[model samples]
Each structure stands twice: as structure tokens, then as C-alpha cells.
Target: MNQLEALKRWTTVVADTGDFQQMEQFRPQDATTNPSLILKAVQKPEYAPLLQQVVAQGKGAEISALMDQLIVRFGCEILTKVPGRVSTEVDARLSFDAAATVARAQRIVALYRAQGVDTASRVLIKVAATWEGIQAAGQLEREGIHTNLTLLFSRCQAIACGDAGVQLISPFVGRIYDWYKKQAGAGWDEAAMAGDNDPGVQSVRSIFDYYKHFGIRTEVMGASFRNVGQILALAGCDLLTIAPDLLAQLQAASGDVPHKLNAAAAQGMALERVHYDEAGFRFALNADAMATEKLAEGIRAFVADAVKLEQLMQAAAV
Candidate 1:
């Protein structure tokens, strides 16, 4: 079997794209989208019509509402292709605001429900893994809305999300790798950090080990992978959201995708349980320079794309 098929035996392969057309070929169990992915998709020639259609329907509505509509429409389309959930992210600008995050998440879920999608089972509202976002997710979870906590870069963030009783946590793999590699500069050793030793892979492994050790029910979906090796290293994760290019690479490469992570094995390891209150969480996050820098960078990038998406919508409205 190809690596993709082999990997599927151990992990639920999720297509991380806003392009539904690409999802059919890989047959990923779930799909994930952020502002950057959606913005990229809507600019494509084939997807331009879909954006125009959404704009036409909500011609005079608030741009933010129309933006939500467009993303939900994409999510709904993605739902038709995949049998499992689709993660639709909340606005990055609201990442630090608990109330606003909850409100926007509710609106996204409501939009999906209006289209007859099963919001309870088939949707994961993606929120940034800020303290406020985690708190907001806890509130939404109580109301029966599932959440996928994204932008997670630290174990503290993962613990907070698990404590919040979120459905899943997406600890970014590639972004962590990027930060460490840039820091290493001339001292970086590509071979040494290639697979299991990769800082990004290690981050996910640490989070996964902790979750399995504590029997935390929140799923761990490794996101923002830099390559197939990172994906292969995390073969047994609950889910791995892969971009189409990497998915294609996996599909074409024939190899044995071994299960590198085992929950039962992780449970046997010595790990201390960690907890974080509001002040503690803030301080913990602030202490990790890499996490702090990357979190801010990721949020800024997403917020910029969101604004660009708005500009596109406005131009389409005109």
C-alpha cells in the first residue's frame, strides 16, 4: 500500500484545505479551513464563482456575516465530500475575546444548522488556543457545540483545552519546526531533526503523551505539517490534517507507515499532570518565547488574510 493508505490504517487522514475539489481524490475523513485557506481558495478560477454566488446572495448584508456565510458554504460543500467533521475557524481578530469568540462560533454553527448539516456531529468550530478562546470553547461545548482548538503551540495550551473539555486540539507541527530551525541558523542539522527528533514532532508527541497518560478525551490532530516525514512520525495521532500537496506525496510514495505513537505505551511513561488557571496560563504562555512569538505571528497572518478576504468580498459586492 502507498504511505497514505498505510497511514490511514493508524490515523484518520484529514484534508486540510478549503478546496473541496481536491478532497474527493484523497478521501480524507475530515477537512479543515482557516482564513488563509479560504482566501486562497476563493481566489482560484474554479472557486471564484462560488464566492461570487455567496456575495450575490448576501449583497447588502454585513461583510462579516457574508464572510461567515462564505466559510460555512465552503464547510457545507466540504461536508458533502467527507464523512466526518469539517473545522471552520472563528475570526482571528476575536481570538483574545471570550464573549466575541463564543458569539461568532455560535453564528457559524447556526449557519451550518440552517443548511441541514448536523452541527453536533459533523462540525468542529475552530478557535485559537488562547485562554479566552479555550474558555469560550468550554462554554460552547456545554451548549453541545464541538470545538477544534487551533494555534496550539504549548503543552499548557493543550492542557487548558483538555480542561475545557474541547472535542479536539490542533497543535501546529510545521510552525514550531520553523521557529526552531530559524533559531538554530548555521547550527541546524537537517538529518538530526528530520523525524522523531523534530521539535515540531516532539511537541505533538509531548501533548499526545500527556493526553493519553491522563486519559484526556480531547482528540489530538497534528496540524501545519512541513513534510510527510513529520506526518509519518505522528502516524498514530488521532487525526492529521494534511495539505493536498503533502497528501498527494503520501499517496504516491509506497512505503511502510509504522505506528510511531502508541497510547498504551504513553500511559506507562512517567509524566506529571499539569494545570493552569488564567494568570498561570498567561504566564506560562508568555514564558515560552517560541510559542509567544509564533502565536502572535499566526494570529497576525490570519487577521491580515481575513481583511484581504473582506476586500475581495467588497469588490465582488460592487
Candidate 2:
């Protein structure tokens, strides 16, 4: 079996893209999209019409409303291709507003329902891992709206999300590696940090071991892979959301992709359970410089793309 096929035996491979056309090629079980990916997709020739159609149909409605429609439209389209579920992210600007995040998540779920989607089973509202976002996800979960907590960096964030009883948490792998590598500057040894020694890989492994040790029900889905090595290092994570480019590379490569992270292995690990209240959560996140900077940077980047998407919708409206 190819590496992709080999990995699937242990992990549920998810396509991390807004371009549904690319998903069929990898045959990922589920798909994920953020404002950035959706923005990138709608700018393409094939997807440009999707934006135009939403603009024309949402006449006089608020632009934000139309923006939600556009994302749900993409989610609906993606659902038709993937069998499991699709993660539609909330507006990143609301990452710190629990009320607004909850409101937006509700609307996104409502819109998916209007599309005849089995919202309860097929949709995961992706929220940032901020304290407010985690609280918002807890609220949504109580209402039977499953959530995927994205932009997760620190173990504290994962602990809080698990406490919130979220359906899943996406701890970014590439961004963490990027931060450490840049911090190391000239002293960074690429080969030494490539595989199991990779900081990013180690981050996910730590979370996985903790979750399994404590029997935290929230699923750990590793996201934002920088290289195939990172993905391979996390072979048995609950799921790994990978970009199409890396997915293609995995599909082509032939090798022994071992089960690197499994419950059995994690159970054998000596890990202490951690619970983070709001104050504790904030302090823990603040203490980690990498997590603090990357979390804020990720929110800003997503918010910028969300604004750009709105601008595109406004232009299409005219």
C-alpha cells in the first residue's frame, strides 16, 4: 500500500481545503475550511461563480449574513463529496467574544440545516481555542451542535477544550514548528528536528498522551502539517487534516508508515491530568510565548482573510 493507504489504517485523513474539487482526488474521509481557504477557493475561476451567485441571491441582506451563506454553501458542497463531516469555521474576529461566537456558530449550523444537511452529524463549527471560544463551544455542544476547536497550540488549550466537552480539537503542527525554527535561527539543525525530535510533532504527541491517559473524550486532530514527516510522525492521531499538496505526496510515497500514536501507547505514558479554569487557562496560555504569539497571529490572519472574503462579496454584489 502507498503511504496514504498505509496511514488510513491508523488515522482518519481529512482534507484541509475549501476546494472541494481537490478532495475527491485524495478521498479524504472529511474536509475542513477556514475563511482563508474559502477566500482562496472563491478567487479561482471555477469557484468565482459560487461567490457571484451568493452575492446576487443575498440582495439587501447584511454582508456578514451573505458571508455565512457563502461558507455554508461551500460546506454543503463539500459534504456531498466527503462521507464523514465538514468543519466550517466561525468568523475569527469573534474569537474572544463568547456570545458572538456562539451566535455565529448557531447561524452557521442553521444555514447548514437549511441546506438539508444533517447538521448534528455532518457539521463541526470550527472555533478558535481562546477561552471565550472554548466556552462558546461548550454552549453549542449542550445544544447538540458539535464543534471542532481550531488554532489550538498549548496543552492548556487542549485541556480546556476537553473540559468543554468539544467534539474535536485541531492542534496545529506546522505553525508550532515554524515558531521554534525561526526562534532558533542559525542554530537550528534541520535533520535533527525533522522527525520525532520535531517540536511540532512533540506538541501533538504530548496532547495525545495526556488525552488518552485521562480518557478525555474530545478527539485530537492534528492540523497544519509543514512536511510529510510531521504527518508520518503523527500516524495514529484521531485524525490529521492535511492540505492536498501533502496528501498527494503521501499518496505517491511508498514506505512503512507505522502507527506512531495510539491509545495503547498513550496509555502506557506517565502523564498527569490537567484542568484549566478560565484564569488558569489564560495564565497557562500567556506563559507559553510560542502559543501566545501563534494564537494571536493565527486569529489575525484568519480575520484578514475573512475581511478580504467580505470585500470580494461586496464587489460581486455590484
Candidate 3:
């Protein structure tokens, strides 16, 4: 079996793309999407009609209604290709507002439900990993809504997500590496390519170990990968959400994909579970340069995509 197949033995591989057309080949058990991905997908020629069609179908509807319809349309299509859940994000512009985030998340889930998508268990409402976001997720979870915490970077973020009893948390590996690499300049080395040495993998491992150590039920999904090496390093992660292109790379390789991260091994490790209040979460996140930088960057990028989506909606409103 190729590494992709091998990795599946120990990890739940999730396709991390907005393009549902690309998911059938990798056969990820689950799929994830963000505003960035939806923006990218609607720009493609093959997917442009999805944009036009959704807008056209909603011609007489409100812009907000049309936007929600378009997002669920993508999620609805993606659900047909993958056997597992599809993550549809809430508006990042509401990341700081707990009640607004919760309302948007409910709206998104309600949209999916209206399509008869069986969203109750198969949908993951993606939210930014802000304190407000986490609190919103907690409330949603009580209402039988599962959440995938996005834009996560710091360990405090992970702890908060788990404490809130979120269904899952996606700790972005590549984005974390990007901040430190740019900040470190020539200090970043390529030789430390796998295992604990990989910044992204290490971040996931840290989160994973903490969760497993405390028997936290929330899942850890490693996201925003820079390469297959980072994915391989987290071979036994709870889940690794990869773009279609990286999934293809893993499918082509025949390396011995050993289980690098095991829960039993993690439980035996020295790392203890941490409990972070709002102040502690902020202080810890502020202290971590990479986490602070990437969290801001992730939110800005999502806001930009949200704006582009609005423009698309406005043009269609005409």
C-alpha cells in the first residue's frame, strides 16, 4: 500500500479542499473548508457556474440568504463525494462576537438541514478559535451542533477548545511554520523535517499529547500543511486534513509509513494537560510569537475572503 493508504491505517485522512471534484480520488474520510477555500473554488472555471447557479437560484433572495445557500451548496456537493462530515465555516468577521458567531453557526447548520443533508451528525460548523468562538461552540454543542475550531495556533487555543468540549480542533501546521521560518530567517533548517523537529508536526503533537494525557474527547486535526513530510510526521494524528494535491503525493509514495504518534505513547509522555482561563489564554497566545502572528494572519485572510464573497453576492444582487 502507498503511504496514503498506510497512513489511513493509523490516521483519519481528510481532504482539505473546497473542490469536491478533487476529493473522490483521495477518498478522505472527512472534508474541511474555509472561506479561503470557497473563494478559491468559486474562481475556478469548472466551479464558476456553481457560483452563478447558486446566485441565480437565489435571485430573489436576500444577499445573506444567498451567501448561506452558496456555502451549503458546496457542503452539500462535498458530502456526496466524501463518506464523512463536511466542515462549513461561519463568518470570520464575527470571530470576536460570541452571540453573533453562535447565530451564524446555527444559520449555516440550518441551511444544511434545509437541503436534507443529514447535517445533524455529518456537519462540522467551523469557527475561529477565539475565546468568543470557543464559547459559541460550547453553546452550539449543547444544541447538538458539532464544531471544528479553525485558526488555532497556540496550545492555549487547543486547551480552550477541548475544555469547551468542541467536537474537533484544527491546529494549522504550515501557518505556524511560516511565521517562525520568516521570523527566524536563516535559522530555520530543512534537516529537521519529521517527527518532533517539524514545527507543524510538533504543534499537533503537543496538542495531541495534551488531549490524550487528559483523555479529552475532542479530536485534533492537523491542518495547513506545507508538505507531505509534515503530514507523515503526524502519521498517527487523530486526523490530518490535506489538500488534494498533497493527498496525491502521499498516494504516489511507497515509503514505510510508520505510526509516529500513538495515543498510548502520548499518554506516557511528561506533558500535562493545561487549563486556560481567558486571561491565561490571551497571555500564553500573546507570548507565542508564531501563534500570535498566524492567528492574526488567519483571521485577516478569512475576512478578505468573506469580503470577496460579499462582492460576488453583490454583483449577483444586481
Candidate 4:
């Protein structure tokens, strides 16, 4: 079997892109989309019409609302292709306002429901992993909203999400590497730590080990990765949402892609079950530079794209 097929035997592989058209080839179990990915997808020729259609139908409506509709349209299209759920993001602009974020998430879910989509079973509302976002997720979970907490970096964030009863948390893998790479400047080795020894992979492993040790029901889905090695290193994780290029690379290579992470292996690790109250969460997040920089940077990037998406809607309006 190809590595992709073999990897599935041990881990759930999720396609991490707004380009759902690319998913059929890899046959990923589920798909994830963010404002940035969606922004990139709509800029492509084939997807340009999706933007035009949403704009034409929008009839000079609020651009932000149109952006939300467009996001749903893409998700609706994606769901027709995959058997599992699709993650549609709430506006990152609302990341700080818990109630506003909750409201926006409700509207996204409502749009799906209006189309006869019972999203309670087939959707994961992607929210940023801010303290406010975690609280919003807790509220949504009580109302049966399955949330995928995105932009998660630290154990504190993961613990808060699990404590909030979040359905899942996506700890980014690639962006974490970017922060360290920029910081390392010259001392970084190209191959030695490039793939599996990447700092991003290490971050997710820490979260995975802790979760498994504590038996936390919340799923850990590693996201935003830079290489195939990072994905391979995270084998046996609850799920690894990978970009299409990396997914294709993994499918192409022939090798013994062993399971690198699991409950049994995590049992031998020194990490203990993590407990994070508000103060602890703050301190823990502050302690990790990669997590802190990436968390703040991820939020800023999402917010920027969300703003850009709104502008696109306005420009497409006429």
C-alpha cells in the first residue's frame, strides 16, 4: 500500500485546505478550511467563479456577510464531495468577543441547516484558541455545536479547550516551525531537524502525550504544517490535517512509514497530565515562545484575511 493508505491504518488523515477539488485524489477522511486558505483558493482561476456567483447573488449586501456566505458555499460544495464533516471558520475578527464569535458561529451553522444540512453531525465550527474562543466553544458545546479549536499552540490552550468540552483542537505544526526558523537565523541545521525533529512536531507531540495520559476525550488534530516529515512524525495522532501538496508527497513516496506516536509510546514519555486554570494558562502560554508568537501571529493572519475577504466581497459587489 502507498504511504497514504498505510498511514490511514494507524491515523486519521484529514485534508487541510480550502481546495476541496484536490481532496478526491488523496481521499482524505475530512477537510479543513480557514480564511487564509479560502482566500487563496478563491484567487485561483477555477474558484474565481465561486466568488463571482456569491457576489452576484449578494445584491450589495454587507461584504462581511457575503464573505460568510461564500465560505458556506465552498463548504457546502466540499461536503458533497467528502463523506465526513467540513470545518468552516467563524470570523477571526470576533476572536476576542466571545458572544459575537458565538453568534457568528451560530449563523454559519444556521446557513448549513437552512440548506437541509444537519451540521450538528457533519460540521466542526473552527474557532481561534483564544481564552475568549475557548469560552465561546464551551458555550457552543453545551448547545451541541461541535467545535474544532484552531490556532492552538500551548498545552494551556489544549487543556482549556478540553476543559471547555471542545470536540477537538488543532495545534499548528508549520507556523510553529516558521517562528523558530526565523529566530534561529544561522544555527539551524537543514536536514537533521528539518523533518521529524521540527519544533512544531515536538509541540503537537507534547499535547498528544498529555491528552493520552489523561484520557482527555477531546481530539487532537495537528494543523498548519510545512513538511511531510512533520506529518509522518505525528503518525498515530488522533488526526493530522495536511495540505494537498504534502499529502500528495506522502502518497508518492515508498518507505516504511512507521507509527511514531501512540498511547503506548506516550506512556513512556515524561510529560504528565496537564491542568491549567486561568492563571496557569496565562503563565504556560507565556512560557512557550513558539506557541506565543505563533498564536498571536496566527490570529493576526486570520484577522487580516478576514478583512481582505470582506474587501473582496465589496470589490466583487458591483
**Residue-wise C-alpha lDDT for candidate 1, range 223-276, written one tens digit per residue:** 999988999999999999999999999999998999998999999999999889
lDDT values, one for every candidate? 0.96, 0.94, 0.89, 0.87
Q: Report the lDDT of model 3 for residue 97.
A: 99
- Clashing residue pairs in candidate 3 are none
Candidate 3: 10-residue stretch with minimal lDDT: 187-196
TM-score of each: 0.99, 0.99, 0.96, 0.95
Clashing residue pairs found in predicted model 4: none
**Candidate 3 wrongly placed segments (more than 4 Å):** 193-195
lDDT string, candidate 2, 139-190, tens digits? 9999999999999999999999989999999999999999999999999999
- Model 2: lDDT to the true structure: 0.94
Candidate 4 residue-wise lDDT, 50-106, digit = tens: 899989987867776787889999999888878888999998888888999899999
Clashes of 1: 0
Point out where model 1 deviates above 4 Å.
Answer: none
Using lDDT as the measure, the top candidate is 1
Cα lDDT of model 3 by residue, 134-234, tens digit: 99999999999999999999889999999999999999999887877787788777776444687778888888989998899999999999888888888
Residue 223 of candidate 4: its Cα lDDT? 89
Tell me the deviation in Å of residue 175 in model 3. 0.7
